[model samples]
Target: MNWILLIIAGLFEVGFATCLGKAKENSGNNAIMWYLGFLFCLTISMVLLVKVSKELPIGTAYAVWTGIGAVGSVVVGIFVFKEPATFWRVFFLSTLILSIVGLKFVSK
Candidate 1:
């Protein structure tokens, strides 16, 4: 299903983003591996998202894809990268999630 592909793409988005951050932090051979892996995943995910977008409304597809990726990456950044997890940051993240859900329903 297109929606399934969309979700997978979102997951890949998170994967690529996390990998990119890791690549930035490391040096030497490990950094190269992470960078290349990130690029590969990002490219594949974008292609899949484009395919799904052909059959779905652009607004809906893009919103869901980006929303999932943004939220997922931020969570990973906080837990894995030990980025700040302030109360306001969490509140804004929740708002983003709610907006995505609202958009999904309204678009449907």
Candidate 2:
């Protein structure tokens, strides 16, 4: 259950990050709505992350949470936001994913 919460928290991290990016691209009323939504999601994600950390080791929780968030956000940035999709960039992202998986399995 705690792992599930952690995954949800990681998803929220991606949501808030994408919202902030959209908010930055636009202006006026929509921007405000996006910013507020980002803040709300970010807060909720943090709270859930904290709860997960209590059950898992701090290092494990933080590493997995941040790794997923970072990788997920970058993927969204590439596909949704139309950022660069260079081979090197994809290679790095794959490396990060592998490292995160390794950590999840190897850590006690």
Candidate 3:
């Protein structure tokens, strides 16, 4: 259950990152809306992180959370934002995903 929450938190981290990216591409009201979304997602992500950290090791939780966010943001960049999906970029992303899964297994 806690791990599930942690994953959701990581997803919200991606939400905030995506919101910031969108904000950068807009102006006025649209930018403001994106910023608001950023704030909302950031708040939820932090709250869940704090909650899960109490049960899981801080180091493992943080690393997994960050890994998920990094991997998710990169995928979003490639798909939604149309960023380049170079060979090295994809290679590292696969490694990050493996590391995240490894952490989950090794962690208590």
Candidate 4:
């Protein structure tokens, strides 16, 4: 289904973001590899988003896709990058999730 594809695309967005962060953390050959990974994932994410947008409303598709990416990226930052886990951060992320779900339900 288109929604499933959109979800996958959102995941790819997370992948690309992770790759981008990793790229900056590496050096020389590792850096190049990470950069390539970032590019590959970013391209795939964009393609999938375009496909989903073709069948779904552009605003809804973009919002949900970016919402998933934002939430996933923040979680990764906490776990992988050892970022702070403030209560307000978690609260806002939860709010974003609710909004994404609401958009899905209201969307055609």
TM-scores, all candidates, are 0.93, 0.94, 0.99, 0.98
Cα lDDT of all candidates, in order? 0.93, 0.91, 0.98, 0.94
Off by over 4 Å in 2: none
lDDT by residue (1-108, candidate 3, tens digit) is: 999999999999999999999999999999999999999999999999999999999999999999999999999999999999999999999999999999999998
Off by over 4 Å in 4: none
Residue lDDT tens for model 4, 51-72: 9999999999999999999999
lDDT of 1 at 60: 92
Residue 70 C-alpha lDDT in model 2: 95
The model with the greater lDDT, 3 or 4, is 3
lDDT of 2 by residue, 45-107 (tens): 899999999888889889888988999999999999999999999999999899888987886
The TM-score obtained by model 2 is 0.94
- Candidate 3 yields a Cα-based lDDT of 0.98
Report the C-alpha displacement of residue 57, candidate 1, in angstroms.
Answer: 0.9
Better of 1 and 2 by lDDT: 1
Candidate 1's TM-score: 0.93
Q: 15-99 in candidate 1: lDDT tens per residue?
A: 9999999999999999999999999989988998999999989989999999989999999999999999999999999999998
